[model samples]
Target: MIKLYIKQAFYQLRENRLISLVSIIGTALAICMIMVIVLVLEVRITDCVPEVNR
Candidate 1:
C-alpha cells in the first residue's frame, strides 16, 4: 500500500515538474526568510545585553 502511494506520488511529481520546482523553491525561500529573521533577532538581542553578562 505504501509502495503504491509512493509510486503514485513520484509519477505525479514527474508529471508536474514545473509545479514541483516552484513548490520546492517557494518552500526554500520561506525557510530562508524565517532563518534570517530569527538570526537577526538573536543578534539584536545579544547586542543589547551588557558585556558583563557574557
Candidate 2:
C-alpha cells in the first residue's frame, strides 16, 4: 500500500540522515538549475525586441 511505502521511505530517510540530506539537496539543486536554464531560454526566445515589454 501507499502508506506502507511512505512509512518505509520515512524510516530509511531517518536511518540515513546524512545520505538523505545530501539526496534532498542534490535533487533541489538539480531542479533549481533546470528552472534557471528554462527561464534563460524562455527569455532569449521571447525578448527579441529591446523596447518590448514582456
Q: Write the per-residue lDDT of candidate 2 for residues 1-54, one digit (tens) a residue.
A: 999999999999999999999999999999999999999999888857787865
C-alpha TM-scores of all predictions: 0.74, 0.85
Off by over 4 Å in 2: 48-54
Taking the tens digit of each residue's C-alpha lDDT, what string does model 1 give over 21-54?
A: 8998999999999999999998887766468665
Best by TM-score: 2
Candidate 1: regions farther than 4 A off = 1-5, 48-51
Clashing residue pairs found in predicted model 2: none
Residue 53 of model 1, lDDT score: 66
